[model samples]
Target: MDQAPPRVQLITSDVRQRAVLAGALLEAGFGVLSGPSLEQADLVVVDGALPPSELAAACAQAHAASLPVLMLATSTEAAREGIAAGADEYAIIPCSRQELELRARLALRHARARAPIVAGDLRIDPARHEATLAGRPLALTPTEFRLLSCLASNAGHVVGWQALLREAWQVEGSQGGRQMVKTSIYRLRRKVQRAAPAAVRILTIRGAGYLLAAGSAPPRPPTCR
Candidate 1:
């Protein structure tokens, strides 16, 4: 069967705004969901007009489930509150369709990167944007974690320099280019070594790019006896 479009859960009290956002998202190739169950949602878009208590609770709940929350704020105050409540992204209300769609695309793309990915004894938990090596935590910054997740997800494949730049830095033609990517990779490897004294297996494929070998698997949850 063909894969379903990435689902987005839209939470808002305003019927008109919900309709607008939903229409824009639908046109942008996303499945619009309206409910409390967020398990399958790639992202959550909520009205910025929500009360602070309500917004904070919603953001916290969504984050706990590894879902990225985007908000439509009515003003700068609302936008700041949205961020304080853990919104991953936000736009002041009355945003252009292009802006909303673009933000959704970026949020979903980044959130998908957070999903748990495994390579060798290394486990990358997208939910928390965290990585564990040999069962020990690696102290990776956000950019490093995102870069590592991108590599780990495509284990055994030479992810090109341009691709890494796009995935990690979200840019195509920055001035630093490949050098920027190389520096990040160097820093990431050093961090990985802190958790696993063994040589970090992320390989630099010269001319081709970077690769994480494919001997990894997601961490399996313990079973009841």
Candidate 2:
């Protein structure tokens, strides 16, 4: 049997933005639903320009329904607010249509992967959009969680930057892909260190890529500096 295209419930107050986004998604082979109800939605895409109260209500409702949300925020602060309001992913407004489509697809992909991932002492629950280290919750944004999940899934192997971008952001050949991966990895490293020092290690393979391995002893300070 042929699978139906994933249905996206897109909500935005601005008619122009809604049309553009819906058209992009439709062109990308996704089914678009603009209705207020989420009865048949496989995912939800929201605009951050909506009044704060309304935005919160929409996200909360989606979260309660176990639907993954992708927010289009007008600014970085708006994006953070959306994430805090239960969105699983976000793209800043004025972004390319390709970026929007890719992010939406990424959210759907993450939502469909319900199995929990275990690497060393780190545990990633995709269905719940959560991760923990040594049983301590790691405060991670949606992007961070996805990045960690990718590295953990490929633990012990050098996961190239391009591969990480494709897995974490669902885009290929994007500009600044390497820098995006680098910045996210740096943040992930810090979070892991704070959560459970020496419990897990994300290693840089220099010229190759990155390796996530079970931690041994913490790295010693430079002997000659």
Candidate 3:
């Protein structure tokens, strides 16, 4: 199935600004939506002219839904508040439309990277936080689930340890998370082994990182002697 472009919800009281921003986003290959529907929205772009409480509430809602938020802050103070309200990024007014588009593109890149990823026998649904192996559910913790999802997203491709930390645990520039990844991968392997021992395998790459062996049942990380 062909996937649709990531949709952005433009929230602004200024009709003219909203229209202009929406048009720019569409030109940049995004599906534009007006009004706030976090569940339906892949990302949110709101105006700073909006009441502070409302901005906070909207950002909060979008974030809780795992939707990324971008705000149009009119001033430095507003930008700070917007961040506090949960916006991942905000632009001061008079900001170029090109910059706005780029910001949205970057946010969507990270967000979409984590969307549902499927391999042969293993199916991973990030939205539902569930993974199934050949019709059987694999027990996974939230962390374990994310780890598996990251590996599955790059199935058959070697994933570096740092990449796994950033993608799965959201940890960056820290070696501490390495141990967490190791332990989590170990547990995840056990779950997969129990759920569909004949199907999936999480491959450890020694000095490198890990990967999810591709294809269907009998998938296992190859041993290099």
The estimated TM-scores of all candidates read 0.68, 0.52, 0.59
Which 10 consecutive positions of candidate 3 have the poorest summed lDDT? 216-225
lDDT of 3 by residue, 46-78 (tens): 787788888988877777787788888879998
Candidate scoring better on TM-score of 1 and 2: 1
Q: Could you arrange the candidates by TM-score from highest to lowest?
A: 1, 3, 2
Per-residue CA lDDT of model 1 for 99-131, tens digit only, reads 888888777777765568977788888766677
Candidates ranked, most accurate by lDDT first: 2, 1, 3
Residue 52, model 1, lDDT: 85
The sequence of per-residue lDDT tens digits that candidate 2 reaches over residues 1-225 is 999999999888788888988888898888998678899999999888888888899989987787889998888888999888878899987888789888988888767686678988989998778898999999998888888988888776777888888888899958899999999999999989998888899888776788788666333322210
Best TM-score goes to which candidate? 1
Q: Number of the top candidate by lDDT?
A: 2
Clashing pairs in 2: none
lDDT of 1 at 28: 83
The whole-model lDDT of each prediction reads: 0.80, 0.84, 0.78
